[model samples]
Target: MNTNTNTNAIAAARQAHSTRCRQRVLTALEQAAHSGDEITVSAIARRARVDRSFLYRHRDLHAAVLVKAAEPATASTGGPSASRPSLIADLANAHDRITRLSHENTQLRQRLSEHLGEQAWRESGLCPPDDIDRLQRRVTELEQHTAEQRRQLAERDDELDATRATNRELMTRLNRPHPDGA
Candidate 1:
């Protein structure tokens, strides 16, 4: 019987505490609405001196906060405007777009300038007409010819070395004493 009574008392205390928290949340929301302050869960929780989870834990309080937050601020307290964080995000996005466009504009100007410069240079008649394909073919031919000359030079060097070796052998044989002891 004592345990049952104690349980009942504990339940009542918990209910009272929950009721107080709910009241505090409602009062805080009302104050915020009147003051035209942003009605976010965190702000309400701070103003109510309750944990954010407390608001979430109570569905009624949570819904109330959502409803209040969605309502536009009255004209008396600085007409409806975007939240600070959202405004900053929008500003950042605009800056990024500006930077991207600036870079694109710079690239376009450079290409245009280069094209105009090339046109002017051509019109000045200072640059001779260039046959790029013919020049490329000539360069390839020269490279092939140089490779062939190098190969030929290497073959001549090998032949010269062989000839020198034969000459040395002949000299050694002529200078040697006759095999018959003459």
Candidate 2:
């Protein structure tokens, strides 16, 4: 009998929690609608301070958010106008595109980190792609500077060789017999 009573009490508490979460989600939707904010699952979840998974799991709240999201926007002073539907559609399309792009970005980042290898990143303390790109640019700049220095050094060596040859020729001429038999 005690076990039965405890089970009943636990069930009641879970039900109450579910009810409260649903109410919060609904209230968040209403507030978003009134404020002309974009009606999205994430926005509602954030406003309600509820987990998004909860919103997705609650069928009623999920349907409500979707319906609200599909509604046309209206001016604060005016009711819904004829042109508002198209504007709302456009907004929904943009939101969907943003969501898709965000997912893609996440996937790309994951792939990049995987390709770069976890051990390499840990050992080098470099973030994927960005750090690699920076290092590549630095290496290229250093290579160019090194090539320039090498060319300058070669030029200086050539000049020194020519000067030394000229000096030796002058010394030889001075040591040689003059045309006047000096």
TM-scores, all models, native as reference: 0.48, 0.44
Against the true structure, candidate 1 has what lDDT?
0.89
lDDT of 1 by residue, 8-120 (tens): 99999999998998899999999998877878999999999999999988888999999888776554646566654666689999999999999999999999999999899
Which pairs, if any, clash in model 2? none
- Quote the lDDT for 55 in model 2: 84
TM-score of 2: 0.44
> What Cα-based lDDT does every candidate model obtain?
0.89, 0.87
Residue 173 lDDT in model 2? 88
- Candidate 2: list runs displaced more than 4 Å: 79-182
Model 1 lDDT-worst window of ten: 75-84
Model 1 segments beyond 4 Å from truth?
1-84, 171-177
Residue-by-residue lDDT tens digits, candidate 2, 2-51: 99999999999999999998899989899888878878899999999999
Candidate maximizing lDDT: 1
